[model samples]
Structures are given as structure tokens and as C-alpha cells.
Target: MKNIFFILLSLVFTSITYAHEGGHGTPTKNWSFVNNNETIKADFIMKVGDMVYLSNENNEVLTFNYSEFKEQDQNYISEKANFINNLNFTKESHRLKTFDYSILLLLTGILVFVFSLFSWKTKPKKYFVTYNLFSASLIMMGCANTKSSKVLKMAANDIPFLESVFGVFNKVNTRHDDQYFYVESDGIPEHEMMTGITNWQQQVPVDHDYSGNNAWAIPLQPELAENTLSTKENFMKGAIAIAVNGIPIFNPLNNRGEDANVIGELDKWGGHCGRADDYHYHLPPTHLQTKVGEDRPIAFALDGFAVYGETTEELDENLGRFTSDSTYQYHAVKKYPYLIAAMKGKVELNPRTQAPENEIMPQAKTRGVRPDLRPLRGAEIIDFENPEPHQYSLSYTVNSQIHKINYGWDTDGNYNFEFVNPDGTTEKSHYKRN
Candidate 1:
């Protein structure tokens, strides 16, 4: 009986062991190759006992029990699944809801503050504190709302800009890239060689060849000119032009051209100035053209300020031989506010047949002249009084035709000009004459 009982006990113990290992089957041993360039070889070994061992021929061994490996694997899988699920749903809806809430809060705060203004029984000190707190809250809420909108816009616009800017580089840098486009010219394209505009290709003339003066000049249409002269349009154009032109555009009242210099100084101190790269001369010379005919000498002017190249002996001679006391250099002054304001649409140019009353005739001024008015070191001047009385004709050549530009500032300190073709046909720019 004792022997039979012992046999039964041994059989029971064997059955229990078999049951524990049922799903696991045999003592399975497997190896997986994880070919890593960083190491000679990384191999994972698993045994039936739920033991995992990681071996890298070039490094030390890492070992983990079955439970630990299983837990880590499960965690990784869960995280990946969650990420995929989130991507499937639209996250923008939540962002929009948050933005709308911020906007509503801002508006509500403003309304409450405004209504508080009419309250009659409030103590002065208490009222002041309350008003300030309320105003601050309103401002914060408004800032939050603006931030949300800006973020959304950046998200939408950033991708396209990145692709446009970097895609070209990637295609050219990668080999076997036959699908890419190459820009060809006799030499490097003029726009490529020029360093001003961020996206010069967008503004470049598509239908014209850029080999000569025609390439340098842009055409002026009545409607386009009208649009460009509008307060917002003018400001935007000027801002964009300055940004791309790599030059400072200034306001007439502030005729101090020092902003550009200040910006350069800041850059030396590790500060970021404008978005565009720095490229301004302390006193850049004006661009000049040789006389083509007996007609008026064509000169390119911005606002009412004429562009002049550096004074050479010939230029000095042309200025009627002024002595040292009378000799003065012409500076390219940028009008930032006028250009920026025009860009912002706050102002408009009204084109009309009637001339501006504030128009200062070029011929009325003298040669070798400087403005008698003292401008602060950096102030921008739209028009300077010619110290020397001299008559000069002005015209802009665009699309292979020369159109005379009428020069003067409006009463409100805006540019007023017209284009006259060789045939004597004149078209006005859009800036309402005061």
C-alpha cells in the first residue's frame, strides 16, 4: 500500500509539471539577428523559460526575465497604438474650440471694462485698480486669441515655404535626381546673383528677358499703379521692397537714416535686426545712366528722392563746380513709415489730373544743393531742397519704353507721381490729391 501511494504521488507531481508547461510546449530556443551598423552584430536570444538575452558582438550583454521583456513590449505597443489613433482623428477641432473660447473671453472682458466706465458710485482708488486689472485681463485674453490664430496660420503656411525653399536644394544635392529642374542662363541668373528679395522668382518678370535695361525695369499699368498707391498697398509694397531690396525704408519726418546703421550695430552685438540680410552702404552712390538723347535725363527716384551714384569727378563737374563749402553728397533715404503704412492699407494714393499743391518742383531747386532744413542724424527725407538751383528731367524706363515720372510729395507727405510716355500720353498714379 505504501509503494502504491508513493507511485501515485510521483505521477501527480509529473502531471502538474506538464500542465504548467502546456502552452509553452517544448523548451523552444530561438535567435533573431538585429543587424546594426553601429555594432558588429546585435542578436536577441529567447529560451522556453521566458528568459531574454541581448548580445552585441562589439559590446556588453543585456539580459532580462520574461516578465520584464513582456511588460516593455506591451508598453511600446500601447504607445504606438495610441499615437496612430490620435493621428486618425482631427486634432484641429480641439484647437479651434480653445481659440474660440479665448476670443469670447477677450470680448467679454472688454465689454465689462467698458461698462464699468459708466458706473457712478465707484471710489476713485478702487475704480482705478479694478479698471487696470480688468484691462490687463482683457489684454492677456486678446493676446492669447491672437497667438492661437497666428499659430494656426504659421502651421498652414510654414510647410509650403519650407518645401519651396529646401526642395530645390534637396533635389540638386541628391544623386540620380533626373526629375529636377535646372535654371539656365549665359551665366548665373541675374536674380540668383542679386541678394535682396527672399523669393525673387515670384516678383521676377516671366515674359521678358533679363539681359539688359528692360530686365532691370518693371512695367507700370494704370490699375496696378492705382492699387500700388493705395495707403495699404503702398505701405505693403514699400515694406516688401525694403525687405527684398535689403535697404532701409524710412519715414520723411524721421529722415534720420540711422536705423539701418543701428540694426548693423545690433547684429554685431548678436542681435537679430530685420528678417532680410544686411546690405546697406552708410552713403550709397546713386545709379546713373549716360545720356541717350536730347530728351530729359532719366533718373530713378523713390518717393521724391532721386537715386544718385557715388560722385566722380565727372558728376562733380556736372553739378556746376561747387567749392568745398557748397559741395554736398546725395544720400538714398528710405521712408519706412510711409512704405510700411502704405503696405498696411492705412493710406491710399488718389491719381488725378490736378497736381498736388505741396509739390516741390525739381527745377525750382539749385544744383550742388542740400536741404536747408536740418534733419536729425537719421531722419528720412522724401524731398530735399536743392541748395543749387538746377533743372533736371526725370523719367523711368519700363518694358522697353521710357515713361516720365512726375515727382513731388502730397500735402500729407505721400508720394504723388505720374507716368508720361514718349508720345506725350500721361497716366496718373493713385494717391488722392489734397
Candidate 2:
């Protein structure tokens, strides 16, 4: 009997030893292994026909057959192996599970005690139930408020950043003067819908002109030459470069002597003249010269509008047509020069028939009438066959050390538009201009 008992004990020991053999079958391709003091970790490609067996330090074996296991089982094995490999010397999942179980048990015990106390007396039962219910309700309310607070904070945090990214513009000044000028337009009457002139205020004086001082210089010579006045091209390019590459410089209008006339000319035809927010024409007038002889004919004031009539005779006839309208006439103020440069090649002899360069002119002249420059209204009938109108804005940075510029454009249909930096990088936004 003694011998049989010994044999049975040995057999049990042998079975455990066999089960504890720690290596898996041949360790499939790309397989790796790690043996910590507590667990043996195995990592391997569990492809078709792959079989793996794992053993803990206690000699308990776990076997996995890749072909037989479900997808979830395979994933679990992978995660388990990863956790084992990354385990630190001081922490393990087993310890976490034990702690969690302890906490749950403690909570259960407290709940039981509380239940017993309430059941001990019928009078106290309702009070106890109400107290516990109220406590739980308060906890839930606190948690909900905390979550809502976090959500609100996240929503509010990025608004300012987004506004800065998009860009912003504010009213800089306003003019109260009421003046009527001969604004060129398509054959349509001045009442037609357009975009550029919404809430348009009278032009402002640049500098000392408002101070009741005649010391402001006015331009005596405004003439057309191959390269006579500062071209809008060069001035606009410089302004844009400055805006994009450096800080912005707010240049006040020039009111000194001959500069005033230049300012006036620029106000009429320069600056960002489009209806959209992206178009930019920064050039305005700067200087003036007086004609002395045939080499220099009587120079028009810098602010004077260059009206082109049907013929040379008409041009001569209309030179002083609005002479009495002071607001419409040239003031010889030094204007912002950059916008003037952009106006070059943009103006046409007849705005209705002759298209402005780089613009989509209105078409479909019905009954010999066309639309003029007026504010756009939502749902206004537009001729889709014709090139849609557009608007543009200019932005630039100017610093002593660097300059940068970005020009933006918006199509009238709100189909396509882009903000283009001088460096050729572009950001696009979509909008529909009704």
C-alpha cells in the first residue's frame, strides 16, 4: 500500500512537470519570447497551422491553436503577450485585479450594513432610503456638470484663434460730405445691383486738409506718359509684399501741397475697388508737377479724373464738366500710392461695353441696358452665361526689415476664390455672392 501511494504522488508530480514545460511548439516565424519571474511571455506570428503553448512559473499550461481560435481570441493573446513583455518590476495586472476586487468587496459590505440599519426600524427605513437616494443623485449631478463644463471650455477655447486665422476688418473712418460724381458703369442705370459700393461713405481727407490750412500742397501736373506717374503695378506689388512679409503700416493720406491732388485721383480709381473682400488696389497718388512749356503742358491736378470720351473732341469738352462739384473734382491731396498702381489696366473707356482687365464683365444686355455698380442683394437675377462679378481685398505686412503681401479674390457666384501670398502659397475659401 505504501509503495502504491508513493507511485501515485510521483505520477502527479510528473504530470505537473510535463504541463509546466515552458516553450511553445517551434516558436513560429517572427516569434520572440521573454521569461519574467512570474510569467513566461511569447510573441509570434500566429499564421495558419501555428500552435503555441504558454506556462506560468507555477507550471500551469495554457495552449493556443491559431487555426482553432476566433479572431477575438487571437487579439487577446497578442495583447496579453504585449502586457507581459512591458511589465515593470513593481506592478502587474494581478495586483490591479486584487485591488479592484478588494474595493468592490468593501463597497458591498458597506451597502449591506446600510441596508441592515434601515431595516432595523420601519420608521427609519424611509429616511435611510431617501438619504442614500439623495446622495447618489448628487454624485450623478456633479459628474454631469463636470462633463458639461469640460465640453464648454473646449468649445470656447479656440474661437479667438479661429478668428485670427480667418482675418478681421473694422471701420477706420467715415466722411459726411455728400457729393455726386460721374461713376463709370455698364449701360444699366445706377440703380442696378452691384457689390462694391454698399454703405459707401464719402471720401476722407488724408492729413492737414481738414485743419483749415492752405499750407497743404496740391499737385499742379497730372499727365499721361509711358512711365509718367507711378504705375499702379509697382506700388500694389510693394504694398502686398509688405503686408504678407512684415508688419502693417497705416499710412495716412498725404495732404501736403501737390500731394493732395494725387490723393484725390487715387480715391476715385485706386485702392481695393472690387465688391468682394479679397480684391486689393493699394495705390493712391503721391506727388505733382507744374507744366512750364510745350515740353510740359498745363498739368492736371493729381486728383483729377482722366475721362475718356468717344473722341478726342469729347475728352476736351468734358474736362471741366463737373468743375463746380468740389467733391467730384480733384483736391490735389497725396493719396495712398499702392492702390493707384493696381488700378492700371483695370479701367476701360466704356465700363458697359469695354471690359476691365482681369475682371469678369457683366453680359446679356437686354433692351440695350446693362447693370451698373450697385450693392448686391440676395436672390437678384444674375446672368449665369456671363462672367460673374467678383471682389478682392489686399493685405500686407510692412516692417523695417521685411515685407510681405497676400491678395484675395472672390467670384460673384461664390464658386471659387483664393488668397494668394507673394510666395505663391494660397488659401482658398468658398462663398456665394447673391
Candidate 3:
């Protein structure tokens, strides 16, 4: 009786040892090879370093250096190696290991029954249930631990900040692949068009497909150009930047090399419909602050720089500056070159219409020109004198000739104007305030 009890105890410990060392089988696939001019089949284990491990039909393990294979076989194994490297082994092994726990619990129950036959001085029934439950709990913990590692790895690759920023724009869809960050839209503004335009008769806003072949994408990482291109002459044409609302912003200067604002072409929103029926902005859309907030970016340049509505710090001539985090950005100004006066980053040069020599008029050399008024089409303020409240005398150049105009409220609140030409002739006009 004593000998039999010792034998059973030794077997129980040995079974538990094997259970921990030998896990459930891993996934295997059939592998074929030619031996002695005969095709041989075996179960493939895995590629370990530079060698492939296999198990023959009789369960004999075999190892072969990858270089020992024929050229054709080497190519086949190389492709399979890539597949095995990227496989999600953590989850797959967890499932198989959990199934092993069931088998372990069953063997533990049998061991308890055999031990009970040898000695029953203690409560055998109570111990049997307790051991089985503990074994099952361990399997659950193993599976949870394995899945958590994969979840954490995926989280590390997510870019949440970019996802949140792009979510703010309407009709804006963004995606990323290996090379570029793509932004797709129909190039339409969310705000009302053709509103508050004095010259809407000449141009009406129209809908454009602006989809498919017109879809725009920017490089995932922006690289600076050797030298920034100036927005002067005919450098900037077509779409230089894209507003968050999906509209394309062109150069502030219209096709004729004239300011769209003074030409009475752009609406109060600083945008107008192009010849392609594409509505776009010539100046910064300052009114966007009411909708998109002053602190947020209003647009993105083709070079992948964010265009903010306003910035407190002084910026370069291009209305661009580096942020606190050293990120380059362009902001809108309240002057002639309102948005960008030049491409602040790298850009592909597109063709632009040449300005005729007659269209490029010279500035006035005889007077002090206002920096703010010089770019206004056919108009420039030379001097201004205010003699009283709401009364002023002004000298301005229009159509390349200087003119003097004096206007104030008469006793009856009627405004009167006296216009003096450069040749010394005067014209008088009056208007009654309603």
C-alpha cells in the first residue's frame, strides 16, 4: 500500500511538469520538398533565424538552413517569411493556450480522484472543486494580458490631434497612406456667396464639381524650398491656398494685376467667382472669425502650412511666422497683401497670365503715397487735412492724376465737394443728407 501511494504521487507531479512545459500545438501548414527526386511532405513549424524547422510524417523534427534550398524554393520561403513576421501571433496563441487549460483541469480532476483512493482522511470533495476553479482563472488572466499588449501597440500609432483638427471643417475629408495626407472636397464655401457685392451683376457665384481629378493632397511631411517665391509679377496663379470651408484662395491681385477689392469685383467677404465658375477669395476672409473663431486656423496653404485668421506677433512679408512650438504658419493681415504675399513653403509653379505693359501703371512720384492705399486699383491717397469734426480736405491720385476734394457739412447738414484737377480746374457738387 505504501509503495502504490508513492508511485501515484510521483506520477501526479510529473504530469503537472509536462503540462507547463509543453503547450497546445501552434498553427502549422503543409510544406513540400524534393528528396532523392521524390516530393516529400511535412508539417512546417517556423523559421528560426536563418533556418526553417519542419516535422516529418513520423513526428521527427528536422531543420534546414535557408541557403540549402534551391533558387525557386528560396524565393517561396522568403515570401512566407514576410507573412510570418507580420502575423498577429499574440491573439492566436492565447486562444490555443486557453483551450489547453480545459485539458489541464480535466487531468487535475483525475489526479484528485486517484489520490482520494489512496487516502481520504482530509475532505477530498472540497479540494477537487477548489483546484479546478483556480486552474480556469489562470487561463482567463493569460488571455487578457496578451490582448492588452496588442491594444497598447495600436494606440501608439494613432494621431488624434490631426484627426480632431480636420474634423472642424465642412465637406473636408482627410486620409493618410504611406506617402501623402490627402484632403478632398468640392471647393465650395459654407457661407453665403454673392452677398454684399456692389458689382454682382458682372459675376454670379456658380456651383462646380471640383471633385475627382481636382482632388488635392499635400505631402505628409512638408519640406522647405531653397528660396520662397515672391507673390509679385505673375508668380502666384490658380489656387495658392485652400480655405477650411473647401474654397480655393487665389492671389489677392486679380488676373489683370489689379486689387480685386478696389476693382469692385470681390464682395464684402473678399471673394468672387472666377472665369471657371469657381468662387475663391482674393484677400483673407476676416469675417471667418465669427464662425471659425479668431484663434483657429482658417485655411491651409498648398505647401501644407496652416493659415490662421490673425496673429499678434509680427510676421514675415509672406504673413508667415513660426509658432511657439516652431511650427511654420501664415496669418491674415489687414493690409494690401492680406493673406500671403509669397509662398512661405515649397510649391509647384503653375502658369499665370502675363500682365500687359499698359496694365502695369507706374506709381505717382510727386507725392507721399500711403502704404495702405498704394495697391488700390486706380486710387492712392496723397494727403488729408481735417479742419473740424466730420469735416476733411483730401488730396488723392486717381487714374494716374492727382485731384483735390474738400467736403464738409453745411449749416443745414448738406455735404458739399469741390474737386480741383492737376491742371487747376475746379468742379463743385453738393448732396443733402437724408
Candidate 4:
């Protein structure tokens, strides 16, 4: 009975110690002190020897001896002081589970176990037990830590994948609250903008902060709607999704229901400047594959589905399909309604084709016409290519004849465009860089 009791007691103590190391306690909040007819509310900042430091609303610091408060209040202060002291020690204990320290210990134990397995035939029974025990102990300790639970929860939230895909935009500050994933950006693309366009409406991509605190918030876990909305004539919205780099992606079709790519408004990267001076994509950001990876998600749709690279396999009418595990996702394609043919998941739509009176082109507006940039009327895209950085070639068909255009900045920083007609005649236009 005595041995059994000792074992149980040790287990309880071990669990308590592990919990303390993993930050187990409710943080103390600001408290109010009642002294006769007066009440003073302040945060219990710190304790120095017998004095307690407190801060008020106006950032005024006040110090008082332990005995200055009433007996009950004095007891409460003593209890809080003890907790803070214990928290300091607990912080030191948690250092064992820090990323660097934990990785080192885990790797060392794994290497020992691996070596032991290779020499198992000749190794002593005690050596095998010791090596295996060491590795197992590290894993068990890691599992006992709440940090491991946090890591697991983050994985469940799909944070690792987001970090990998959206890391390039970290400078713009990306974060998540309980319900929404917030991203703040200047709405500018790192890639070159508006290279081969003859009529440049808003040539410069301006900065717009859509961090979602007051503007846009993407649902963390999007719920699928019973009735999915199709991407059709009436459903055309300004931006259906946002790229990881913070630039919004509009519908492939313009307000007139014509393909934006065919209309020759987008640059070589399938993006152009908006009326609000915002740079965004109207087609699949295929050029981003070299940066974000071909297999990984290139953009996240408003419906909360990730948009991946195109595949030869056929998808549903919405340009979306499910993963092997039945996780629904959208993919970019070469055809019309490229990024998303329709919203597969649930989303709130305004149903109005025009922006609200007070609207300022939000980063994730569900329904509104993209800024009307009139494409060279009657021109249909034949082909668009980017042979090198800052260089672009566009082919279009007008009046039953094919025409070619090559446009970019020359080595001397001169903006130049060469237009060739089917008759083998060429026209050149030049502009100075601002």
C-alpha cells in the first residue's frame, strides 16, 4: 500500500509540475479597492519588497506598503504577489520545452535510438532499453506540454500551410482572431504591373490597408451552403478572392461580361490597376507558381477554399473539386471563369452590382462590379506571353485579322510599344518613365 501510494503521488506531482511549466493559470486582471467611501480601480503592476506598484487609467503610478490596504485587501495582494513569483519560476521551467532546446533533445534521443536499432543483434538488453526509453521519454514529455497542443491546434487551423503560402506577405501583417483571418496590406504586387497596356486608366498600384479590423475578414473555417451560388452574368463581383500577397483577384470577366484577359486590360502577370489605384488579378496568377509553388495554393477564395494550380483532370461546373480526403478546394484554369466558376462554399453577398454609397473598394467585397476599365473595344486576345522579367508580348484578333504587340521599358528606361498588323506594317509608341 505504501509503495502504491508513493507511485500515485509521484504521478500527480509530475502532472502538476508539467502543467505549471506549460503556463497553467488565469492571469490576474485589474482589481478595485474599496476604502470607506472611496473606490480606486487600478492594475496590480508589480511588487517591490513590501511596496505594491499600481497603475491607474491615466497611466499614473502609485506605490503603497502592504499594510496600507484593509486586512482583506492586504490578503488579496499577498496572494497575487505569490502567484507572480511562482509565474517567474514557471517561465524558467518552460525554457526546457522551448523550440530550440526541445528540438536538440528530441534529435539526440532519436539518433541514439536509431543507432541502437542498427546494432540490436549485438547490443545488450539494457542498452536497447535505455536508448528506447530515452526517446520515448522525450516524446511523452513533449506530449505533456501545452505547447504541443497549441502546435496541433495551429495545424488543425491550417496555419502551417498558410504560413508557407502567405509568408511573403508577412511584412503586411497577417493574423487571425477567433472567427476571421485578418490580412493587412498595401494592395500592391511585388511583380511588375501594367506592362503591355495601350490605355492605362490607373497605371499606378496604390496602397490600401484591408487588415479586416474595420474592412475585411475571411472566415477561418468556411461552412458550405446548401445552395451554392453560380458565377454567372448577374453574380459578377469586383473581387472574388485575395492572393496570398494581399492583392485582390477580380472575376475573370469584366463588368461587360467579357473576359478581362481577352479584353487586354491586364498586364503580363494577369493583373492591372483598378479605379482605386489598386493592383489586382483578373485571371489565374499562373506566373506566381514559380514563387508560391505549382502544387501549393496560389490564392484563397472568398468562399474560404484555396485555389491551386490547374490540372488535366476535369472539375465540376464551379471549377472546383474535392481532395482525396474530401476537402473541397478551387483551382485556376485556362478557360473562362478561370479561378472560380462559382462559389462552392457559403458567403454573404450584397446582390448589388454597384458599390454602396459609402463603400471604398474593400479588399474582400463579395458582390460589386470591378472598376470598369474599358478594354480596347472589339479586340480579342489570341495569346499573351512573358518571355522574361518586365518583358511582354500580346497577340489579338480584330476585324478577322491577327495583330501582335510587344511592350516594355528599354535598357535606357524608355517605355516603348511595337504594334504589328497582319499586313506586316508596324507602329511604335514611346513614353517617358515618371
Alpha carbon lDDT of each predicted model: 0.29, 0.27, 0.57, 0.64
In angstroms, give how far residue 170 of model 1 lies from its true place.
19
Q: Which stretches of candidate 1 lie over 4 Å from their true place?
A: 1-77, 80-84, 120-124, 152-434
For model 2, the superposed segments whose C-alpha errors exceed 4 Å read: 1-182, 185-412, 419-426
Error of 4 at 178 (Å): 1.3
Backbone clashes in model 4, listed as residue pairs = none
- Model 3 is weakest, by summed lDDT over 10 consecutive residues, at 360-369
Model 2 gets an lDDT of 0.27
Model 2 poorest 10 in a row by lDDT: 241-250
- TM-score against truth, every candidate: 0.20, 0.17, 0.43, 0.47
Ranking by lDDT: 4, 3, 1, 2
What is candidate 3's lDDT per residue for 1-434, written digit by digit as tens? 45644554555554455445323344254444444344446665555435666666666667777776666766877777677665634545755665566556555556655665455456675454444334344333344333323311111112344445556776777676664445566545666554444333222333444444445554445555434555655433566666766676777877667777776767667887665435788887767667667777777677777788877786654668866554677898786667776666666542234422111111101111111111334544555566664455666566778776675555564656677888999998665534
Model 2, range 1-434, lDDT digits (tens) per residue?
A: 45644554554454345335345444332322232224334433212113444443443434445444455556766665566445533344544554555455445446655765766576565555544543343333333323322211111112232123112212111111122111111111111121222122211111111111211111122222211122221221111111110111111222121222243322222332222221222321211111121221111122323211111121111122222322221111222222222221112122332211111111111110112234323211111111222222323222312112122223333334444454667776443434
On lDDT, the leading prediction is 4
The candidate, 2 or 4, that scores higher on lDDT is: 4
